[model samples]
Target: MASHRVMKIYTVSGCFPLIILLMSTMVIQSTQERTDSIFHYTYCAIHQNIQTDEEMGIADLLSSIAGDIQLRQLDLRSLFPAERFPIQIRFNLKNFDISSDAEYSIAIHEFGVIYEGSCALSGERIVVNDGNGSQRTSASLRPDDTGALFMNFIDIGISLTGQESIVGRSLVIHGNGQSDLEVKYNSTRLACCIIGESDGRSW
Candidate 1:
């Protein structure tokens, strides 16, 4: 019995360093995965028919203007696991007309623009509408001269956990200028694209 105990102790001591090395490898892999979990999306083109809305008289003009405008990149980072603060989003536009005074807002929708069903589900808009005045002003839709709109590290006041995650959702860009509200409402949809990974998996 003494000999067996000595053998067991020897085996455990021999394997302890290997076990610790394995655990260290697992921790490193987990840290790498957590660091790389930030989601990325790219909006390429305007898929929907922008000229069909008769209520918006400038549909043709907007469509013509947006024909050259391309959403270059979108990067989204989750600040916390299930918290309602500090969700960072960045977007870059390309070939956009900087001379226009029209401002744009990005929104997350439940259904895609091509989804045919009840108008209720189709039109349900859940945007990052934190009513904090300064926060809202900071998050205001203002693109730079290079056509880059950065929602840099802003607290969007929403939980993006499990079912609340905005992945695989439809993202729409609304054209809102400092003009008539009706005009803004009518010409809201400037571009529409589904948010997906950076691996060209967008719909």
Candidate 2:
């Protein structure tokens, strides 16, 4: 009986670590898979509002069509070691009577200032360029035979998630001849639109 008890004890002790490791892996996978996403923001730019600021004009009329940004990757938002969550930005914009196929850089600014029907930008560029495994900036103005430009960014390296909230900011399009922020009064900025927040059902 003593030998049998000792054998049972040895078997249990030998199996304990394996059981614990399996449990830990299951917990990790469960935590990783439990993430969810929701669309909680909106940014709409219009042609009549933002097109007049350019020197020559990137386009005569530009407006947003069903653009969307979402607050996603719920798992990474809370972590012991902070990590970056994926930001998904989907926007559809059309510029009527565009002149060329030059590429334009898109950036989010710190402020959304609308003055005299034109978007006035201030502060910093919150999200731009490509880095951290995502393409966050630059867009091509693909003009068709009609001389109109159509721009669509669908998961092509743009997202709305940021460490700091980017709501109530400005999305500006910069032309070829200038840095995103130029001079004191930046009249060379091609287009500007205010970023707003909305629920999935409304706006």
* lDDT, model 1, position 70: 20
Residue 103 in candidate 2, Cα distance off native in Å: 3.7
Best by TM-score: 2
Itemize residue pairs with steric clashes in candidate 1: none
lDDT of 2 by residue, 104-202 (tens): 556667787867655553456665535445544445444456544443334323345565556677776655544333332344455676776654332
Q: Each candidate's TM vs. the true structure?
A: 0.49, 0.50
Q: Per-model C-alpha lDDT, please?
A: 0.47, 0.49
Across residues 109-141, which tens digit of lDDT does each residue of candidate 1 receive? 676554321112335576555647432211245
What clash pairs does model 2 have?
47-62, 87-159, 88-159
Segments of candidate 1 deviating more than 4 angstroms: 1-34, 37-49, 53-85, 114-122, 127-139, 177-185, 197-203
